[model samples]
Target: MPYASLSEYNFFEGELKNLQPVYKVIPYDINSSLFTDYAIKKRFIWMPKDVQANYTTDREVPVFPIGTVLIKNFYYDNTIPNNTTYIIETRLMIKKADGWAFANYVWNDEQTEALLSTQRETIRMSWNQNGTAITTNYKTPSTIDCATCHTINNVYTPIGVKPQNLNKMYTYNDGTKNQLSKWIEEDYLDTKPTTINSTVDWADASQSLELRVRSYLDINCAHCHSTGTSCDYTPMELSFSQSTVPENLGICREPIDFVTGDQQYIVSGQDIQGSLMHFRMNTNIQSEMMPPVGRTIVHQEGVELIEEWINSVETTCP
Candidate 1:
């Protein structure tokens, strides 16, 4: 659907394979090795001869609109036959035309397991020609999240760690999928938030959440939140995925955070207590935000979801 194989569809070394209709991919995520991803530590070695030509040079078109194609028909349930709940991220970073792979993780039925099982998201890349209205190559993705990944760019930037409105594709949460703008589209009261929980087979997700969440936290917040880093002493080592972190996104790591007493940086459960998530969401000058470095303002829904999830955590984290 989205990729020729599973990971990236490499065309850098060889010829363009299946070039989807220009419109198939949204306008903004057109990052073709041209822009500088400040977070990228290693510069890519291979480059296509006509990297720029791939797009339609017309001014109004943004990028050229050759044709149209539908990679993933998210509309249809079970289009993804696997009983495993999917944690798919729209990773657009393609490596050497040939060096493309992805991770397709599997969650449990009803999707309530340890996190390790879903440590990896389902990732895929390809090298197919963009032809007609639809293609089935999407079924056999090569790899998972291993090949494709996020750079250190700020959240709001094109090359940020957090998933932005990339590829202009539908935004993916655990249960629902929709266009980012669609959330506010039409009447706000139109379609209420749907309850779309995932369904995995069994209890295999424990390790998935543990390892994957750790890996994610390592790549994402770990850079600055680790020992000796900005958040010294306080060891969150928190993770998110198929697994369940005790406080979820709580600022349990910091005792006095945004709180009145002891003078810590955040409070675990209280959003108003200046929890790390809350502070990160704050753009006001009066608020002492974190990362004060890269990343854009935190996603409001993400913050609220984390807060709600924290409230849902059992007193004991199994």
Candidate 2:
């Protein structure tokens, strides 16, 4: 079911009926979607007939054979139990012989179609979210911008497709079931570990605030912060599985790029006002903001969550 080009399939139309049954619709725990954007859905499809993906018992991400296709759709919804939604964009990740290739399609004004574009563009959109009038410069990233976050260790890889992130339960048409087990049962995954470590479900109130915050940072920032990546020179390790030690997690640490504001970069045991992490997360200004791309609006909810977490802890670099 692989297409020679992204335009070959009319996925933005009603073609989902054909693809949904063939592809494995997957979900992640933390939900790394941009703020102001409601509900992001993902599906993974393998092109090779009768070839299932090999599962990893070593905790590394399972590598799919060439021709694997990963699809993600973004939408903006207006009200409770939203009856109407505006399609924002759709992104596709294809595994080629050389490596993974990326493409992004911006949905049309009619919402019935999406067009593949080579240049990044912004679509000014408006919606009534939670009874509040909201407007955003919905960003459609260029082909090159797609590589910035996907590339790891000089290789393009799919983030959040790892076992730990995908080890939770997912609700299908049949019923709710563990995603790993479902994948194995459906023959999408060859095999999986008997016992798998799981990342936190950020929206679940039962989990600790610390766990939720860490999970958020792991999926959202670890791409560049991990060893050998763009931010490798820094000491911070935002990986979810990393040790909870202060130094490893950047508590009470000084800014790496000499970003001296009125407060310390990450005041280990301080409130939002003095925490540099809080400052950076609160703004979208280049050189001051994190995740430098894919977002034109600040994620207020995420910023508030991190702010609360930072204020709850007390740590010192010394």
Candidate 3:
């Protein structure tokens, strides 16, 4: 349940568990999150009896009413003997009278509460995943930085709440439930579209490589790369859809300012080293990376997948 007033309670204190039940826990097929080494969990909450979100077709994100709230928690397992999960921060999106308001609460040392913070913090974090010791600074996005990608068409919209992204099934305490269907039954969402276009599960090797790579790019880069954004200064249109042009997809396209490898090809087929797309994605440098911020390390698996797709599609770029 959502708090009646944005000022009513201290969200930084982990008040969600005591106030009301969870509205919904929505997971994405592929999520574009802030660069961190930990697993993330997301949930939706709304003021009781508030208007439900409206559905749409053709790859549009769902529209939520005033008083709606979205919550996301970033956490990781403690490497100590008990291996307890520790939450680093919790982000909230509340639909106020003015529109969506963004806030972040940083968890305290005790883990019992998090405090509202306006500035970004770098938490030196370490974890053992499959017995591999991994460590990194978990960067928390400042409240202002939250709007950088979330602001679409001049509005602070939730990026991943689209029909296509939320079309998957989830396992819950009661049972397995299809998110969209459950949303409808709970009256948390309205107007089911006849057709919901779901993107590819990028890690699934059985799916089409083209669809997988394009879908990955859509979430990871399309927000800034779409028309009218600063990235649009370049010719690339990374949004994955039927109408997207081949050149926009970086087929034989060339970077405007910087040289790609030893050649000019933005995506030199079968040549990952020569492709600017691969080069930028594989880098963590502040100025040269495709995503200028929010990530400190390259997503090696994602780069490999895109490289495989590029290798299979074309032999050369002219």
- The models' CA-based lDDT, in order, is 0.29, 0.68, 0.68
Per-residue lDDT of 176 in model 2: 90
Give the Å shift of residue 163 in candidate 3: 0.4
Task: Give the per-residue lDDT of model 1 (tens digit) for 1-318.
Answer: 234332243312222112222211322221111111111111111222222212211111112111221122111122233422222222233332333222232223332221222143332312222221211222212232222222112211112211121112333332333432332231211222233222121113443333433333333454344333445344453322312454433335544344223424343443343345454544423245443333223433334544544454344321
Worst 10 residues of 2 by lDDT: 27-36
User: Arrange candidates by TM-score, highest first: which order?
Assistant: 2, 3, 1
Better of 1 and 3 by lDDT: 3
**After superposition, which runs of candidate 2 have C-alpha atoms over 4 Å from their true positions?**
1-7, 10-39, 42-44, 57-59, 79-83
Cα miss at 261, model 3 (Å)? 4.8
Q: Scored by Cα lDDT, where does model 1 land?
A: 0.29
Prediction-by-prediction clash tally: 58, 2, 0
RMSD of each: 20.7, 3.2, 3.6
Q: Which candidate leads the pack in TM-score?
A: 2
Segments of candidate 3 deviating more than 4 angstroms: 1-35, 78-82, 242-244, 257-263
Candidate 1 ranges beyond 4 A from true positions: 1-219, 227-232, 239-252, 255-267, 270-274, 282-287, 314-318
